[model samples]
Target chain A: MVNAVTTGADAKVSVRNLEIAYGDATALSGVDLDIRENEIFGVIGPANAGKTSFLKALNRMDMFNPEMKVGGDIHFSGRNTRGLRNVYALRRRIGVVFPLPVGLPMNVYDNVALAPRLGGQRNRAELDVIVERCLRRAALWDEVKDRLDTLGSLLSGGQQQRLTIARALSQQPEVLMLDEFSIAVDPVTTMRIEDVLKQLREEMTIILVTNLVQQARRLADRTAFFLDGRCVEIGVTEDLFTGEVRDQRTRDYVEGRFG
Target chain B: MSRSSVTDFDRRNRDWYIDRLVQAVVFIGGISAIVFIIGIFVFITREGFSFIATEFDVSGFFLSQNWRPTSESNPTYGILALVAGTASVTGLAMLVAIPFSLGAAIFIAEFATGRVREVLKILVELLAAIPSVVWGFIGLSIMNPLIIEWFNVPVGLNVLNAGIILGLMAAPIMTSIAEDALKAVPDRYREAAEAMGATRWQVIAKVVLPAAKNGLLGAVLLGVGRGFGETMAVLMATGHSVNIPTSIFDSVRALTATIAAELGETAVGSPHYQALFTIGIFLFAITFVINLTADLIVRGIRNK
Candidate 1:
């Protein structure tokens, strides 16, 4: 049941009948979603609901694990992602931030510059500009500007979270997948990052996966509610909150009832 | 209801005795290792000192370049040449071993999975199980001639030859320890790198290797310790010449080789025998320091 108004628009990422399994256990099964271009697409679900797995699948992170088995099609910009020869190029265009912030063993400056360096932007001045722009976009420039040489791992949790955001942003991705990016961040920092995500929406598609229903409500143009590894409902964010959810479970979850 | 049968008093009594028994057993286990080490140290030192009493030429013992204990007119106790030989062979060995070992480590940690990784690990363990003398035999029969033919040297029994053998001897150990270090790096770091468009090689070179830096260093140091103390292999491969080697190709004698080669023939109470004991002290001290420092660095990294 596709919404007539939004179904055929320029979709940035399209997933069809996506099923993911790790050994004997299945993480996600029969998931379908289309993330439109330059829109903040929110994913709200409870723990173990395969929200992170979905984000991981979007970036083809399953390639790292031999045990992980993925079935069905995931397309990026009308091209089948599974068929892409250069996975790194596809990954560069689809950046992901995990639930927990992962700081590189190197310093802050190097952390942001690393992706660009991998992509062959070796000029120091150019890296410096990219790093500054990304950090500024993530609202982390002022605190870390003076300490760019400091070890990335030594930053405070909130700052580290922002740095992860900045690092992902530095890649200049087509679709930015943030999987519970604010879990480690404080409420104030979460709001700041939310502002960053809203600002980033004009340039690229945003896939914000969160446990907080209100966060999805606040930022998403269209929202998908995942339960037991299946999308229960997907509608305009306002409809999910304004007593117009297609599924009763969506209304219950959005109204702060059972997940 | 069952609480009445197994009361707190009875449980506490059983727990206390079992805990004491465990404590005593663990203490004995831990203390025995230290005691054994200390006892060995004392024994070696006593033997080394017994030699010193007759001839206390400490400077000649350490700094002298000539080692002619068998000379009829005069005997020199200079160990500089032996030390030089040991240094050259070990240095060359390390140069060969580190690259191959690190490569194996990266392969096992980042690339191989499932049955392949398991098989490789067992193969590494089997490589280590092969006796040092057997490795020496392999070097003597196979590698020595190859080296001579490859480099067109006068003799294959030189520092380079010994070094190659020692490098093989140390590679398995180096690979295992380095693999441990590389494996200790969390998956998240690798994922973060990959998600940022980093290739497999780039992720390893930049993130995983750096994260495993101290552990990798510890692995190298352990390899050095293994190379330094290796006796039978070096004894067989190195030509056992007491002269300092001018190059890796020149025939040379490691300290262990000298001790191993000369100790059995000399009269037990003689200065030569005691001097061999002195060389053992140097080997022990150097091994202890390298291993201890490596342990410290690894622990420091883990703590951080």
Candidate 2:
């Protein structure tokens, strides 16, 4: 779908002719995207449409899966990320949250403290501030502040999701990716987290992958509609929702037709 | 009978009977193991009761450093020296085994890829396959001379030599079990930690090892138990001096070694022979406690 679009020089993340596969089975092919800085770039796609694969590619999370293979040029903040020796540094800057509530098997405080600790922050006072700030930003401080000693895994699903977000936030990321962050979260918690994401975009670039098309309309500045391992449409969220989607499939998806 | 004539109800009833039969079979199979273990304990303790009643000095048997079973006139059977010997050998074995075993486990679980992991695993199994008697022979012939050359001790087959060989015997078991524990760690934890910029070592040290604590404990304790109960290797490797070891190089008599050396020569129904049963109880108790603790840890892991 991005075949007609030109690569934006000012984009924070630029993908060109990207193709991804696991072993011999292709997941995505001939994909291109330019994600501008400090915008909530929403990726909306059906299940198995390579939305998570795209996100995984950005931070080289594919390293964990030996079967996964990528053939593309992905430039993050103007630096090429292909075969980069320091993938951990790249991943640290591009924080990611999974589809499920995956709080670390540790206390609430340690969950948030982990990223900062990984970054070599040893001072108890500094860690406290970092943890508190991240938790507050994730809108989990009020619920978890009194029970920082409790295991994060023991929390309610919504709370754990928030704690995961808080942990991601503690990484001091330049780009924050939330992959179906509201999958198990309550509607109220979802709205709260959406609001938090809006605020977060002011400080860092946000990539929001969601099945909820309306969630994209609510929070995304720019949205890409992925279909069957291809980008079917890419435009402003408002333009995509304005009953004039460039692609018919995007209109169909946005209007609750066949995904 | 026609296939259609056999109703679904009849087939279901047949399945129910078969399932119950299988269930009963499995129940008996499981209970037999427990019954056998209990039977061994009961039979041994029955033989030991006479010794415990008359000849066994409960306190001095453990505290006193005398272990003279062969003395014709005044045969003292204080097992404190034997217990001390067992402790030193087992303790020294642990010190040698833990780092190497954990290193092997980490390498297999975290670092080695598919084929390499399998190859390393086979190597560990090969190590475990070597008999205790062969290890004892190797220590006696090859290692003892090297020790005498280096340490300049009169006899090279001292506590150090026995402990070294025992450590070698136990390392494979420890590594394999620990690796299994490490492998059992959920991938999500590593993914989360790595996403937070934690390196591979950091993920292992902070997350994988901590998450697999129970398994690691079980592995180490079971390994220690192996060292504790090993009879042939310690009997051949240690010089079997009946005294408290002042140093790692000092010759000592482990509980297993004492039993192996004296059991055949002692007359049946004699106090010395019955006292050997008491020593059996000591060995049984230590092995039982270690195994039980390991089982508890495994159960706790399963419960979690």
Candidate 3:
């Protein structure tokens, strides 16, 4: 029934009857959701729930995958993303952090500065400021400032994850989508990044996709539970854990009884 | 316990003996390569030793352009003209090959998809399989006349002709290696750069090229090696005149061509024959160094 709902002008991103398939294998079907502006929206799902496909669809990454077929309308900032002539322009406005860190085979300073450089900011002084601020916000500046010229791939796993976050932040995107950002991060660093996400929520719409239900409870204002390529329910994060969900499957999933 | 069921851990079975036999065979096969290389080196050194110890003039051998090795009154053994000819041809070949090979490689590795990629790869391998003599024949019959008509030169069998033929000869192999280097760059890097709003060209130029730099350099060096070692094509395309060419139209001779043309006519123990063997040693050493450097650079990619 939610798939039939009309779009709202207030929503930053609106998905309508979104269907994703990869070469005859359906990944997600009949999914409808609206992500509002400046809210920490969470997606909690088991593996193969099409959570990653949802993020990829928003940024138009399906262009790279010949087999991936996206069949629906997705509106970002009140404009249809599929109709845009320049997809790169649309992607620049939205940033994504993948499940695993990719350090871009460059140095630490260059890693964070890449997005801004791509945006045509050539002033060294301005770029240095942006790089330092992004790294500090990602909680990686202290460890990496002394060795900014060293290769980013040389960083440890957790440090690389934080560097990815810093790189994403440098875009100053209106929307930030992160898929399993804490998979390679230690618990202490995870908590630190969780704080960074909360601070970032005031400026951008944050979409956090994680398997950790407790993380959703901690950071998400509204959470959507996806299972078997479907969105089972979307509700207030606390309500899902408090047994106020519309579906029994949502309760079971949050309670760790079953996925 | 039954007699057949009794087990002895120390007993070597048939499979164990076969495995040991295979290990020994492979060891011999591996070491034979080094042995053969050393044997060839020793033979060449022994043949050329007499000339080097007696009448070899370092300055004249390297600097003198005259290579008259069969005059009764005054015979000389200078290779400067041959060296110039080889250097000029190889240099021009690189100029022609680098752009073509790199462009072909980028298309094959990054842009082409499915049937196009498969067909292109097969075509490139087919190009590489073409015989050097066939390439030389094309140069002599087809390119020679074309060059003379186009440039209005007195002769066409010169540096430009040999260089173009050699470049065409070397491009496919360079393209193959360069494509491998580009393919070896992880797809994750491209995805990451694309996610940051980089266009396709931007992703290649900024991320992929930098990551695959060492491998690409190795590919270029391998192409240089291929150019230097190519004998038949150079022998046919170059007019085989002994001269230090001042222009592309001037006919010249290569060291390999000189050896191939002269080794049969001269007596084995004569100074002229030994001089040709010395040139062989020089070529062997140069090619060995180039190939080793290329191999090391290619291996650097794996270490990263």
lDDT tens string, model 2, A201-238? 98999999999999999999999999988998999999
Best-fitting candidate, scored by DockQ:
1
**Tens digits of per-residue lDDT for model 1, B133-243:** 998898788878898899998788889889989999899988999999998898889989999889999999989998999999999999899988999999889988877
Index of the highest-lDDT prediction? 3
lDDT of 1 by residue, A103-135 (tens): 888999999999999999999999999999999
Candidate 1 wrongly placed segments (more than 4 Å): A1-7, B1-15, B50-54, B57-59, B148-154
**lDDT, each prediction:** 0.89, 0.89, 0.92
Stretch of 10 with least lDDT, candidate 1 chain B? B1-10
- lDDT (0-100) at residue A123 of candidate 2? 100
TM-score of chain A of 1: 0.95
lDDT, candidate 2, B18-114, per-residue tens: 9999999999999999999899889878878898998777787888777777788998879888998989999999999998899999999999998
* Model 3: residue B123 alpha-carbon error in angstroms: 1.0
Q: Calculate DockQ per candidate and list them.
A: 0.84, 0.69, 0.81
Docking class of 1: high
Clashing pairs in 3: none
Classify candidate 2 by CAPRI docking class: medium
Clashes of each: 0, 0, 0
CAPRI-style quality class for the chain A–B interface of candidate 3: high
